[model samples]
Target: MKVGLYFGTFNPVHIGHIIIANHLAENSELDQIWMVLTPHNPLKKKAGLLEDYHRLHMVHLATEKFEKIQASDIEFKLPQPNYTINTLVHLEEKFPKHEFSLIMGEDNLKGFHKWKNYEAILAHYHLYVYPRISESTIPEQFKDHPHIHKIEAPVIELSSTFIRNNIKEGKNIEPMLPEKVWEYIDHNLFYRK
Candidate 1:
């Protein structure tokens, strides 16, 4: 099985996330697209992040309907400041039959070098990049890399930050997220700051 690992905090999975996952599963060579919910990203700030379990549940709600798309909390059991390379290594050990690949946005590529063992990631696994609306070009260094492939997945300008802000301001985010996810957030009073 060829699995595309879409690593995220999923701080609250939104439509944009589903869109990308669905696009990759349907249009790409990947058989499955797992939304790897990272409990922590070493290079990112954890200020506004919700509890790991809540974020994981929201992802579960958001992706429940898709058979090919799954919500994985594998990182939850891993060490803090979870590194992608470490997770990849663990995944390979656990799922020996699956070929794992990394799915990321072109915007992330700008800072790819900063990630731990990024070179190993590039050398060992395929990277499927979706273009962000604002990032018009791939970095010069990776423009011709055979392991990196650009995917023309439909881009939704909606962001989790935008949705979170709307919720904080008491705005309706029904259209921005899956119905179940919004209901989960509302019922649980999440992000009601």
Candidate 2:
């Protein structure tokens, strides 16, 4: 099986996220897209992130109806400050039968060189980069990476931060998030000030 690892905190999974996953699954050669719930990302902001359990549950809710998508907590069991390269190594060892590829935004693709063991990652695994709102740009040196491919994602401007802010401000967010996920957030008081 060819699985695309879509890693993120996903404080609360939004419609935009669902769209991207579906778009990739339908368009790419991937058989499935795992929404890897990262407990703590080494490269992202943590100040506004909800608890990992909360995030994971929300992802599970959002993707419940889609067999092509999965809510993975692999990073939750790993040590703190998760690194992509290490996570890839672990997944490869654990699921030897399946081939794992990365699913990231084009913006992240430009910074691949800064990541730990990036050279090894490029050499060993395939990358499926989707376009973010930012311009899709790859550094010249990385243009020839053997196993890299860029994909065009669906047009959805909504982000997790925006949803969280709407909830905190007592604004309507039901339209922006998956119904199950919105219910979970409201029931648990997630992102409430």
User: TM-score of each candidate?
Assistant: 0.94, 0.92
| Candidate-wise lDDT, in order | 0.90, 0.86
**Superposition error at 48 for model 2 (Å):** 3.1
Which 10-residue window of candidate 2 scores lowest in summed lDDT?
39-48
Candidate 1 stretches greater than 4 Å from native: 41-45, 135-137
Clashing pairs in 2: none
- Per-residue lDDT of model 1, residues 1-193, tens digit only: 9999999988789999999999999999999999999785556777668988899999999999999999998998898867899999999999999999999988899889899999899999999999887735667888889999988878778788988889999998898888998898999998888
What is the C-alpha lDDT profile of model 2 across 90-124, one tens digit per residue?
99899999999998887887778899998888888
TM-score of 1: 0.94
Instruction: Give the 10-residue window scoring lowest on summed lDDT in candidate 1.
Output: 39-48
